[model samples]
Target chain A: MSTNGFGNISIMTRSMAWLIVCFLVLPITIVFAVSVTDKHYLSLPEQGISFQYYEKLFTSGPWMTSILQSFVIACASTVAAVLLGTLCAIGCWRLGNRASDFVRMLMLVPIMVPTIVYALGIYQFWIDLRLLDSYTGLIIAHIVTGLPYVVITVSTALAGFDPRLEQASLSLGASIGQTLRLVIIPNIKPGVISGAIFAFIHSWDELVLALFIAGRAVFTLPRRMWDGINESLDPTMAAVAAVLIAITVSLLCTDAYTRSRRA
Target chain B: MAGLEISNVTKKYANFRAVDDVSISIKRGEFLTLLGPSGSGKTTLLMMIAGFVQADRGDLTLNGQTITHLPPEARNLGMVFQGYALFPHLSVFDNVAFPLKVRKQSREEIATKVRAALDLVQLTALADRLPRQLSGGQQQRVALARALVFQPHLLLLDEPLSALDKKLRAELQDELKRLHRKVGLGFIYVTHDQEEALSMSDRIAVMRSGKIVEHGTPTDLYERPNTAFVADFIGKSNFVSGSVVEHRDGGFVFSGGGVRFVQRTKGPAPAIGAGVSIALRPEKIGVLRSGETAENELAGTLTEWNYLGSEFRLVVDAGPFGSFSVSVPTWQSDLAPEIGAAMKLGWSAAAGMVVAQD
Candidate 1:
């Protein structure tokens, strides 16, 4: 085939890819541009650059505390979800029975059911258990919501894994636990890490669950951002949003890097 | 050097018997192949020997010690799976060192053994490369080195060369045979390829439907299959169903479909009226000139001809006896047999053997 004969389809596909890329990136680019503006009341960049909004955000007390609380909650919840969800997915894969399939569907229910329903029900359950407004309660709620990400990613990784590796390891003087640690975990490390990262982001950015479950004592970043936006339109709020967007971009970039590495 | 003995081992998954009362013994340092087609229970039998699958009815012993209840790790057996199964994340050195590490060998001992194993497979230069970076043949050698590094009591190869191309498969077969001789460990190989079994094994257990129908040396199984299934499966054969005409010295004469055949067989050769089956291998039947004579001669016409590089396969239509194939060496043949040409086919009485049809 001649290069000229590659035809209009090749050019069309190239332009279409760029169009999709722009579609996904335009909002974030706009938010970045607005963040650096001197007047940041949700307007375009028509003024000089300034760092006063970022300074304002740093001086804010509740926002800083909420950021720390979000980090703590996300970290704790991701650890719990990845641990429990990976084990559950492994069990389901090995068993391949009706009961385990039902359990797998149950694990996926959080992803399917509306968050509002889960929040309302979980709020009532926590109140009955006297766990409402507690950090433990919030962590447990995030874990429940974040576990499906761990399950899906781990299951995707396990699809390429040969069950015979487990057999081969066991046959070669390794115990079941040793096989899980040495063979299974090493092979699925990328998937498990990606799942944990996604779960952490899910918990960190979650607003409705935090709103329904947490109180004044256990406010998170998203909850505080929701309150800040509702109360007043300030440049500090835009600065905080921009920082959250940066964290999300960093996490997504990390996920993409890990995915490419796995490939 | 542990010899394995399996006694009346039966594996029942629900109602279907995957390995039914199958018993075989592997002597120390012997290379035995479980040869069969797909779903013939060869792999299941190997898995049972490796302790991956438990036998429901019988016991297994290695070096006279009961290992039926032992886990695979405790059995101290090495295995090479169908698709190499080398860890993609690990380098070749680490993969071969894995078994030794699992055995809790010292770091220095592991290095020495891994190098020795890699050198044995001629893969020392590729030790630092990951498995995915190597070709199919190299990956297979890595798997072999990994399986052997720990010096296990027995080695199980489950169709180890099945994943490679034909040329590479043949190359690896020679390497595997050499490795077997060097290691001098008991090897239980499983493969569906009959030629692989014939070329590499000390003895072969021919399996069909979870049963060991025949077990013998490669020559014995090829030359003296006891059943029609075994005779047909091991090589190409022309089966002539007949009724016994007479019992003679160490043999019998049978007549089938208006054609007579003499068979060398054991026992009373069935009663005079009993039905029988005679199996004749294609290469055993010689193509002859017009005036040739033998203990059995048939008049036929060449119905089909195929040139197989070194040999000519001719399907001859013998009247009332159906089509019989004769394989003649191409080098020895003066002229190619033309299609529809009348030809004479002959075979000695010993070439055809009576086998049980079932």
Candidate 2:
């Protein structure tokens, strides 16, 4: 190819890349921009920034408690999902039979089944267990919703590991338990970390399951946000949303950075 | 007493019998190689011995103790996989120390043994490096050091050198033999490379279709193969199909394609008019000049020639016998052979033997 042709191709590629970046980033940028508006109502860029709405959030609203509750719920639900999902993935990978396949599909039921249907069933089930409106019920619901992410991420990670490493460890006089702990878990570290991140984000941002299960005692961030937008038109909701976006962005950036380091 | 004894070992998966009834005894401190192509049950037999796979109708004994029902960990055997299987997250020192640490050795003991094992493989300086930090050959040495560090009673290697380049493979082949001697441990090495088996093994068991077709020392199998399969697999062999004509001088005279060839044998000579096959190694045949005399000579024309550095491999179109090959030492050649050049090929009767067709 000629130099002029190469130059033209390079310019075209650079513009195309920028187009894609803008397409993906524009909505999130707009969300952040709108969340910090000085106006009392949601709108475009404003003349100044103010902490009045944030102060109102702390003094008059239950937003702080809901944020703390969301953090607790996300942490508990993520831990539960990661433990169950890792074991399930390992079992399916080893057994590789119809029964394991059935288990895998069952675990993925929450993903394939519509959230409304799941919410209705879980709502009734929680009432029977006397867990409705309780933190335990909220945690269980989020765990069920987050389980599939853990399974998929861990399964993908385990796919790259050679089974011979396990065999080699066993042959070297390590028992099955030692082999799993020393060899299998170390090799699948990335997958487990990625899965934990996904599960955390899933639980943190989940709304429908919480709406069905958490009534009075358990008010998570998303639930409070839902009520806030419905009840009022204030700049404080924007500040809370801005904070949520920042947390989510930081978590996603950490995931991407760790994945790149592993690569 | 044998170091390891496998009696009538058989393995079946569904309808496919991966390892048919096979028995072999390996001696202590001897390097025995299971030589065969893929799906030939060599690896399956090794896995059975290593206690990774169960045998359907066999008992594996080590030092007169039956271990057919034992698990891999209980068997206390060292195994090197095809991929080396070095722990990527662990440093070379920790990798070699793992087996020892699993046995709950003291930290000072582990450190000493790990250093000594690394020195054996000449990887002492790389102890702190992770597996990925090392090159392929270095990773292979680390694997070997790990497998041998614990001084397990037996060692099993599954195509350990197959992952390396051809030249590196040859280099490691020598190191493996040297390690085998230094360690004085019974080693069951699995490979498909005929040259590796011939050079490193005290004995080789050649397998086909999940069965051992022949087993013997390198020279015994090469010069005196019991079957044509062994003859062809162990080395290059040109088979001549023919019928036995007469019994002569404790041997048999075979007539085929308008030529008569005599084969010396200690087994029952083939009946007259019975079909027979003769196995002739390419290197055993000599390209003869005019008036050159030998035990047997046949006239032929050179069809193609390949220069293999040390030797010239010529394909001669011998009538009736079809195209036969003769390897000529390049250093001894007075003149290079041209394509279509008429030549004479000769070999002693003892060089070509009557081998079983199967």
Candidate 3:
């Protein structure tokens, strides 16, 4: 007698969707529960609730430094990507359709190829340039990886933009620069912000490329977290994962909120 | 405040000439409507005048200053796009105030001007709403207000009312005319609707294949179109192609399909035996009753007819002379039409105008 909210979709597919949702949430839930466990080693929440691991998260110098470094790199790279990528998208949009499409595809090179391959290529290039393991090198690499996200989102934003709005502005005595700043930019801000969010997230949890390219000179949070996991089951690791999940969820929620605001 | 002269303006796109040596002298405070079907280059010509498009070879002078190479912003023209193109994010107030803000006007000046513009369009109460929050007609008014806020020298509208429903379109048509009169700004309006052009414009330029085939007052173009295209495009006209049999002071005789048609022309008459087409408006041709008489008359069978409320549009088939549409008022007590019934169609000699074949 009940339609199960799907209206016409079969019960099998509905249950499958719920099953997938649970499957996805289970690991995060377990890590979140483990993060609060009172035990010394990593274990489930059969023990008493403890703030000890979370306390360690804030107190540890090296862990805090890694987190701070990640934040700096992510902020720097997100800024660089959003600016360059948004401008690039505007350039492509002006170039007209076919050429714009080709340029857009070209911008996606970093995203299209395997990360390890591009990372290795970038490492060789940076090593030759003597920028290896430097903040500039890591930030540049992060920007290159993040560029595609900003380009795609801004391009998508520009897609719905009525070009006549620009014409209307120009005809009403605003220069091209004024039109972009006053009209085009604000309309596409949601896209640029979402792109920034993606770029930040991309740089924040980047381990593979950072692992190959960075060492002690630039010890990022993910790089340190990866090392901690490899070395030992530090209960602090569960706490870090829980924090990472929280940060990613918040970033995604912001993206969703902005996207819905746009709609 | 300004009169713009477009002299020999032309735009070529690869193999096609989008605007071909098109020239129109838009007088100060004139409401000129460029009426044409799609691909007739009315939009292209409008774009050229607005400085959005660079003419291949021409000179555009606004108040005697050559502005052919000027960018749109430098031209200081107002334009309303087909979709209204209101900024979705900005409120009606900000949208209307954008020009003043970009020019760095004082906050007080911007508020006053924007308020006046909104009030002009009757959208003062809804100034705080975004474009999406408004209905189609409201969005249109906002676009109008935004363009008019700057008090531009000339206003260019590109099929601005095409997006609205029929009733709203008629309402805005009056609104546009009232705004033009109130502001006294020169306006260049583009539309494909003949009725809209006829009712609203001081002068209508009927374009065909990248050229202004006819440019005149709506009544002038309607009554005396110089070309077959203009006659047909400006309004419904029944064209009869033939060779001139004789040329005279009052009327010229042209014969086609075993029927000799007499047409009136004020211009230089074509020589006898020259090919030409006569354009006759449907309303001009009346039903000749039993004793009624006209300058010219033809007998034909009514093949098709449509009841157009105020009048009946009958398609009369005159054998080899071809089918002609004749509009007869329903109130007139005369020959009532029935399918396949033979009837005599008549029009004065002045009703059929001699139009160029090309």
Candidate 4:
């Protein structure tokens, strides 16, 4: 009845919060229900449930191949993006003035622009370089888009780091390389892991860039799902979405476990 | 043989000089402290010795070898930073063993040395605990163990105990003194705390504005400070500026505050009417009896008084000479001090030292 107490939830506010949670979670739950439906068509089950779509997804030729292809592409892009972005972040942190600010802003350009506009220009350049529909082409495109996540996460980690640790290591008869490996890296490992996880997720779920850059040979999971939805409405697409969600949840769990241990 | 000599060291920033042609040295087993206030070049000189900041101009030699340009790792100096700088991710044992591990020591050697070092700090019980798991004092011990485990040529400490509480700081100060005596290695310590500097160091170098203003044994500096800055910085002092009255006797006479002061000077005698400043320690000034007189005496009122547990600090307002503080022992006092009580203060000529104004 009154607003005097701090954080006291009114019935209206409590219901509104639950409403937003359901609004976000209901669609994913429906897809999960449809993935295990006994029916072949894309519909949530009323009574009976079976994992026929998942069984088909594991055994089918195109589905398994697309999953494997996406896995390799996502891992490769994440590795490249995390390594490059971490180095860039360190260099920027070391430079630490107006110039590094300009460089950091430039690195964020890939996230600022709409992907659709740049997708057209990139596809044209890829055709000239004969890299269209290739794993390298798709992975490179994914890395560019994922770099900002890695850089932001790693930079935040570095920001919290104490530079005096590096100095102490140096004073204790450790060289520059030893200081970085022993003192600096261990202190910032949480940031690096989260950055890698974010970059991997960014690449794994990316669609527009993959849709334009990839074709038959390098069909990522997202690309195949896009094509499947356009051509046919099977319950297997729901199975694919469930698998993607499972992987994302696992990555997030890994991040949370590491951060909690750090604390 | 492993003594260090700093010859005319200098460091400059963009436009300002941080250390200006300062030179000091210590023997192999001496505990030398560079004491100063903030921005007084004490830490800057320590960093140069540790090779974190190179001296723009000067030569630093250890034993007989020049180490002016050596990198920090190659300099073989141990430093205890103010915040301890213990590795948060490493256990206490691992943190202490880091220097040995980097030096390519065998497993048995590292384990034995780390155990001994941890035992020295009395933290062997917490060897397996991470640095973050320990209290502030425990972490400081781990840092000391880490710095000492390597047996570097000399140890450099930059206000290492400044972060701890007063009780913990006193505890660690005792621990550090014991370690110094047991290990017998040269120590170059930097601190703005004059009390710590006086209590810990075998020799103290007082710094001011990028220079070593004075260097001597603590007692020597306390008794015979060369300048007003050193006198005021080292401890509390009552400064009285006066013109020399007469050089009739070997002792000099100066008249100020309507009080004639017979002063002692170790240097050459000043001419008559020449200006001089005298530093009188608070405890040295005394409460004269009704008829008794000393070499120097003044009459004033006890305007205010603070009753410290062990001593009473009395502020006497002497007209024309301004106010000066006098500390009297509580147990030996015969008179209970009351506010606005008229009193006579007196001290021997030897109690006041002639100091330069600058």
- Note the Cα lDDT for every prediction shown: 0.88, 0.88, 0.90, 0.90
| Candidate 4 structure quality by residue, lDDT tens digits, A220-257 | 88989999999999889999999999899999999999
Pairs that clash in candidate 3? none
Off by over 4 Å in 4: A1-7
- Calculate DockQ per candidate and list them: 0.76, 0.78, 0.86, 0.82
Provide the clash count, candidate 1. Answer: 0
Better of 1 and 4 by TM-score: 4
Tens-digit per-residue lDDT, B1-358, candidate 3? 1599989999999999999998889998999999999999999999998888899998999988999999989988888998988888899899999989989999999999998888888888998888889999899888888888887888899999998889999998998899899999899999999999999999999998999998999999998788888888888889778898998786688888778877787777788889888888999899888898877888999999888888999999988778898888888845566899989988887888777887
State the lDDT of candidate 1 residue by residue for B1-358, as single tens digits.
2588899999988888889999889998899999999988898899898888888989899998999999898988889998978888889999999888887899999999999999999999999999989999999899888988888888899999988899998988998899899999988999999999999999999998899999999999899888998898888888888798988899888888787878776556688989998889999999887677888878889999999989999999988878998899899888567998988888888898678988
TM-score of chain A of 3: 0.95
lDDT of 1 at A28: 71
lDDT of 2 by residue, B270-353 (tens): 899999998999988898777787776788889999999999999999887889988988898875789999998888878787
Task: Report the lDDT tens digits of candidate 4 across residue range B217-325.
Answer: 9998898999998898898899988889888555799887566788876667788989989998999999887898887888889899999988999999987777889
Residue A114, candidate 1: C-alpha displacement in angstroms: 1.4
Of the true contacts between chains A and B, what fraction does model 4 have? Answer: 0.85
- Which residue pairs clash in candidate 4? none
Q: What is the C-alpha RMSD of each candidate to the true structure, in Å?
A: 2.6, 2.7, 2.1, 2.5
Segments of candidate 1 deviating more than 4 angstroms: A1-30, A33-47, B266-268, B331-336
Ranking by TM-score: 3, 4, 1, 2
